[model samples]
Target: MDFDEYVAARGQALERFAYVLTGDAHRAQDLTQTALLKAYRHWRRVTAAEHPDAYVRRIVTRSYVDWRRRGSSREEPVDVVPDLPEEGASADPAERVAARDELRRALVTLSPKQRAVLVLRDYEGYDDAAIAATLDCAEASVRSHASRGLARLRAVLSEPTVPEELR
Candidate 1:
């Protein structure tokens, strides 16, 4: 596909990948924008690759991993806090939403490399060698990151959520 067509088709997916990698929508948007800009500038080389989607995903993943080295801020700027769930909200769907939110929070606690590794492995279904290639790291590093990241997520997710009354 041409550059514009690629962007038009895969743009939302790219943004979602960035969001999962960064755990912040705003940063994800910035990350996607930056990666796509680079990809556009190198369109020929990217499209010439065996798997152009993986190529662009690598750019997004690597960019997220490298953001720390560039000394970017840890916290995002927000205008206001989000509202709590309504009292009458049903339990089943609310529980699912809460579970997803908890998972997202747990993900953000991992180091950038670990987070990227887990997302690519568990979320995106990439194999070890593919993850290594995308992250430009060793296979051993990918395994290490994945193991440590899973352990961390387990620890975080296992913690008890304090009741509103207790808080």
Candidate 2:
């Protein structure tokens, strides 16, 4: 497929991948844009690869890691907590949102490589070999990262939820 067609078909997926990797929408957009730009510059080479999407995804993951290493991705603390839905509000959606937010918070606590391994293996459903390829690490390293990442996530998520009144 041509570069433009490939992008049109896969841009949103790439953006979502970036968002999962970075845990920030704005950062995800920037990461995706940067990766796509780089990929565009080598479009012929990328498209010639057996799995072009994998090539682009590797770019996104590497770009995120590099951007974080440069220390330009400072996370600002939220000064105010948003009000939770009122009592008797639709319970399921609220619970799902809270759980998702909790998970996201837990994810951000992981080291970048661990988080990338976890996301690629668990969220993106990639195998260890594929994750190793994406992260440019050994298969054993990918397994190690995923194991540590999951352990950390479980530790974070299992912490007792703070009472609402405590806020």
Task: Pick the TM-score winner.
Answer: 2
The best candidate by lDDT is: 1
TM-score of each: 0.81, 0.82
Each candidate's number of clashing pairs is 0, 0
lDDT value, residue 100 of candidate 1:
67
Model 1: residue 30 alpha-carbon error in angstroms: 1.1
- Cα RMSD for predicted model 2: 4.5
- List clashing residue pairs in candidate 2: none
User: What TM-score, to 2 decimals, does candidate 1 have?
Assistant: 0.81
TM-score, prediction 2? 0.82
Whole-structure CA lDDT of model 1 = 0.82
RMSD of each: 5.4, 4.5
Position 52, candidate 1: lDDT: 94
- Model 2: per-residue Cα lDDT over 72-144, one tens digit each: 6555433233333345654789766876676666666777889888888877899999999998989999989
lDDT (CA) per prediction = 0.82, 0.81
- List candidate 2 stretches off by more than 4 Å: 76-97, 160-167
